[model samples]
Target: MATFATSDQLLVIIDPAARQTDGESVRIVKDVLSAGAAAKVCLPEGPEEFARALGRRGSRRPVVVGDDRALVRAVTLLHRHRELAGCALSVVPVGSTLALAQSLGVPTSAVAAARTVLDGVERRLDLLVDDSDGVVLGALDIPPAPVRAAAVAEPVSAASGRPWLRTTYRSLVRTLAPRPPRLAAVPAPGPCRLRVEVDGATVVDLDQPVEAVSVTPGSSGAAEVEVRPLSVGAEATPLRASGRTVTVVGGDFRYRADALVSGPVRRRTWTVSEAAWALTLPAHP
Candidate 1:
């Protein structure tokens, strides 16, 4: 466990979504931080304000008060400015789902997380940066078609019994859909054709259709890649690889990176940067 100076200053940014949904948790977080050190709080109403708050943080360590998405946004903003390496972050997760935060070793309860923020040690962590300069702090997945097939069928079934109407409704739904998350992976409606490569070695050629794929930052300064092929019998063997870089090429595919969903791109490549960022966690006893 690594320690920090008790006198260290902190800047706590509260995500608007958290404020809207759980004001009590936000208040508790602020009180805990205030009791510990010289802390400044910023409640950003939207994305732009959130970015600006971090940009102006000066020398204070940033402590995010929200869920996984909020933490990702902060990391991405810091990474863009190339200031991520020099700063350590703390998180007090307050939202519906905290899978990403929990995976990172952050405490789940409001009080426990706040205490961690105030007294935790700083630890280095790896990150995945894609070709588009996007960042993923945890696992990235390309799920099988069956995972989302029923979802597509739901809206169609709800439209009516007419085939043409169903087709028209589906088209309309596609057209009206909002743009995917800018830096996160949003799952596609169905499976896609993809060719995966790790460290320049081809793992899955486009000729053979794949069921799914996943890429995660490995502890040994490498990216862990897994390719799940379409199974014919009981189960099919998965191909796995570990390397500094992983690339995928296909028609258009979607992927889930940690808690956020992104994509519908022709191709994307991600490289692991060892110990690229730092986070706060409780000191080991």
Candidate 2:
């Protein structure tokens, strides 16, 4: 655990998406943070600038004002530079998507999140690091889910009060809407044969076709893995295991890590880095 003084210097990096998504909230966050601490704010125009700003943060603590993707980008950049273990990060969730931040105990409101940044305590967290140097802050799913098309709505004019509200409403509707029933004539997706290994032991092999696979960083310094195999006449039970390392081998496959999707690769491996990073959250959260 780590604690910060109110006078601590801060490197506040505002993500471009946040500014565009909710300028009012972003301004509120900036105002609150500036009033609470000695902060240097950086308005990066793109990912390159974001990385550079974070890399040059020096000794000041980093406080990201954006959504889940921005938080993931900051963590990934720091992890790539081997600086994650030494730095504690803070986030002020101020964008259209904030599930990751909220799930991690971050306050959703701009003023509340800003206060958390000033008065929060640092807590070390686990991470899933892939062979390709990718990091997953939340969960990882194999065979990435198909992206859903958003419900079409009339474009909000300048008279609209808040664009973010409209966006949120659309997202809520999408979430609560019933998924279309699969047609009986159309065959379900056939499972892919993949070899999954946990630690050094094989949990599933190519002999068994699997419908899906999921991996999440466990609280006990390991990875919780589940493989759902395909069954002919009976429902197949998911094979589950926990280990420090997980490797999957098969034909080209894709995976979803946090918010991004990657691969069409034949093989991939992920290892658990116990308490590999730290994040600042509300002191009592």
Candidate 3:
């Protein structure tokens, strides 16, 4: 339902750090946008360098050429600048593990993804902000220990995984990686009570001792909160919720705040806040 004028300009911002990791692909990105030549492109130093670039972005539909982290950074910048509410955000994902791009329906190959940028559609999706001031969308996973190799020598470790997975890489990395994200709140076998209030309901009482608790707040306050006992192979996908605040109770625990990895403390309690931030996504492809 959102539209940008063909006459309007476009600005491209590529994360410099992303460039180092995928230099060739970054060149491809520049070439594709340069193929347009006339569209304005803004290159920032990194996630931290985006603010000044933020001040200069005009009314043109913004195009991002990088991985999920870069995408998140740009969107967060626009949201903070109050530009997301009105603009159509686009991404030409350049990373091998660009899962969120697939979720957004952008092509994976730099060239094809660029074509999507050339002819794209717009969608208004939800943005997630954690209690520790982290902003994200697509996923916030709390994984168990990485699945170790069975003593057999393999050509690749999860850390060294090829960027060749295309659309299936994210799920693959999530499944095969030996080391996964940790939970700040959940300790080992020792059980601790956690309080959970979803949509303001005391759904999880203090009587339950859980291996860990996960809460995700969705758009409009629809929330899903869950707690599971810890077992050697036990796992839980990040739960979804849409409450303003989720207060946990019981023994002290810490939690990861998005990609920063687990770092929250509950002096027997934790509060999770959910809200959407402005994000510019690809418009046509």
Candidate 4:
């Protein structure tokens, strides 16, 4: 059984942009979390500063006091440092943009989110790592979408600076349409051939152009490879498969994986190693 560290300190990293939107709620969360345990708060000037802050994250339990992108940024930073294993993490949903927290089943209310610190359960989940060495603790693959500045997604990291526009747009649209698991399919100008092999055995090979491909790697050389076909205004659908090694080939086009974009590469692959990371949740649901 996993045990919580009794002396672990909750290190709160606030998103500067979110601060403008939820500063009071953030302070309330910080003060609540600081009741007994030590709380250290820092405002990320932007994405780069956010990465530097997390890179220097010491032995403290990371407690992000922002929205999902903030959580993604910290998780990416931790995965980049290969510290996802050593560090246990927490998040407070202090923004109107709360899709990430909802996906993880974290509460949206500041008080409820803070109570997660005491009652949340630890769940070991797969972290998606790509061939280019991108570390994503959340969704890894997204179909292509019209190029909107961070308007569609935000990188798990904040390098391009926190995606305030993405956050705002997401919030507005979510209220109007609410984020549906079923997302309209982005147009695919051409076909993408995906050749998938596991343990040296071919699983899926196609010449049809796919709208998008997402790869999520588990810590144990296992991953979920999803292939979404390009259909006009198609809804989001998951193509789920688990494997030791997954490779995507033959696409002279670009696509979005969560919050970032990778160019028209010939192919890409992912290898999941045997180390698991956990998220704070009641169940791995």
Candidate 5:
């Protein structure tokens, strides 16, 4: 376990996505933080610069002003460097995507989040670390959701005369015409023959196919594993277990860990590091 002391000095790193998405919110957060503490802000253009800025944070408490991805990136970098144990991170969520931040109890509003960064308490949190050195802050799901293909727009040639007229005609036709409903006949994904094990005990074998599997860091210093097996007719009861480690093996499978999708490997294992990191949240009443 590691200990942390609250400090008035801060090293604030504003992510580029946050700035591009909402500059006004970023400015407001910066203003509030600077007014409340001795803050040194850095605007990193890319991931490399972001990592560099965080790597050299010194003793000042590190505060991230971005979305969930930025917060995860900071935690992953710190965890990779083995410095996460001693650091208490703060986040001022400023992006369109912030489900993870909201799930973790961080304020969604810019001013409230900035105020939490200054006056909140440090709460130790659990983490899920995989065999390939990947970190999952929130949840992990097997067989990630399939991405929908984007519609391609028709190209207009410059040589064609009155392209605007053609475009307007097509737009008007599309708006006024009552087209027949075209239903897509997409099939649902089949079950996977995965072997799941929890702390060395086999929960499910390869013979049984499974609909889905999920793993999450539990508050009790362990991971919660749930496996939903596929049945012929009725719904199969989900197998649940809690342990320090969880392992899954089968054919190539993809998984979504937090916001990112990863893996198509045969085997993977994740272990829970109890109280692995700390996050700043609103003080308890």
Candidate 6:
């Protein structure tokens, strides 16, 4: 087991969802953190209490025991308070689906992760800050109208297996029935009219319609921007750019950032902030 510098003060914020879903993991986390440090635990029932607890945390290092959303909440709160640059946050993956924490090099298991809290090193990372001061630690994607249409029209299985039976019956009827008359093709919806600019350079003008747009933070302090155009007869090429800032202007458009969907606004700009925050992760061998 890795050893710490001893008697490190820690503030453990256990999300309510973590307590409800995995009591055992929560107990393990509390136990391990207590064993290694002067750990003070906080069980906030909701967002308000959660915020209050952190605001009163003093100088203790904050350790979150929850899933990805919980981690994001803590980070967002810290960022807003202007304390993110000074704090090195730690997380114990206590609930289901901790892909974000794991991808950031945190141990998935409760015991290993809690141990990491005591023994891990801090690593600085970049962030995408929107015009509204909202933060995105991961990729942002904007899909075309056709993709949304397909998602909406997709069918689900019924309790009686009627969807499967319907498919089978339709297949048999098509084989036995007479040929039906063909119908004319319906016109597809027009592309999204967006004016995309990267580092002040226009990638897609207002007249140039696009299929999708994605922005992600690259390793070299730049945001990777991609603008996919609507396909014509053949495959359509995607316009790509990388810069410190990206701005998109259009009529009420929405985009997905990480797991959250945001906008329907006329404009949004994302600027890359290099090494804006730090996280505790296991040291390399």
**lDDT: worst 10-residue window of model 3:** 141-150
| Model 1 CA lDDT for position 54 | 92
Off by over 4 Å in 2: 1-7, 149-190, 231-234
lDDT agreement with native, every candidate: 0.84, 0.88, 0.58, 0.67, 0.89, 0.84
Off by over 4 Å in 6: 1-7, 144-191
Q: Estimate each model's TM-score.
A: 0.81, 0.83, 0.64, 0.69, 0.83, 0.77
Residue pairs with backbone atoms closer than 3 Å in model 6 (clashes): none
- With a 3 Å backbone cut-off (N, CA, C), the pairs that clash in candidate 2 are none
- Strongest candidate by lDDT: 5
- Which sections of candidate 4 miss by over 4 Å? 1-8, 147-191, 198-200, 214-221, 228-240, 282-285
lDDT (Cα, tens digit) per residue for candidate 2, span 102-161: 877899988999999888889999999999899998888887777554343444555378
Of models 5 and 6, which has the larger lDDT?
Answer: 5
Question: What is the C-alpha lDDT profile of model 3 across 121-218, one tens digit per residue?
Answer: 55555555545445555544332222233242233346455565533656775588897455355433355566666546675566654566655445
Q: Candidate 1 — which residues are off by over 4 angstroms?
A: 1-7, 144-191
User: Which segments of model 5 are wrong by more than 4 Å?
Assistant: 1-6, 147-189
Question: Candidate 6 on 1-285: residue-level lDDT in tens?
Answer: 544443388999999989977888899899989998888899999999999988888888999999888888888999999989998889998776587788778999999999998998998988999989888887787742322221211223352367678787668867997885565564544568899999899999989778889898887699989898878889789999999999999999888776566778899999999999888888872
For candidate 6, the 10 contiguous residues with the lowest summed lDDT are 146-155
The stretch of ten residues in a row with the least summed lDDT in candidate 4 is 148-157
Please give the distance, in angstroms, between residue 6's alpha carbon in candidate 5 and its true position after superposition.
8.1
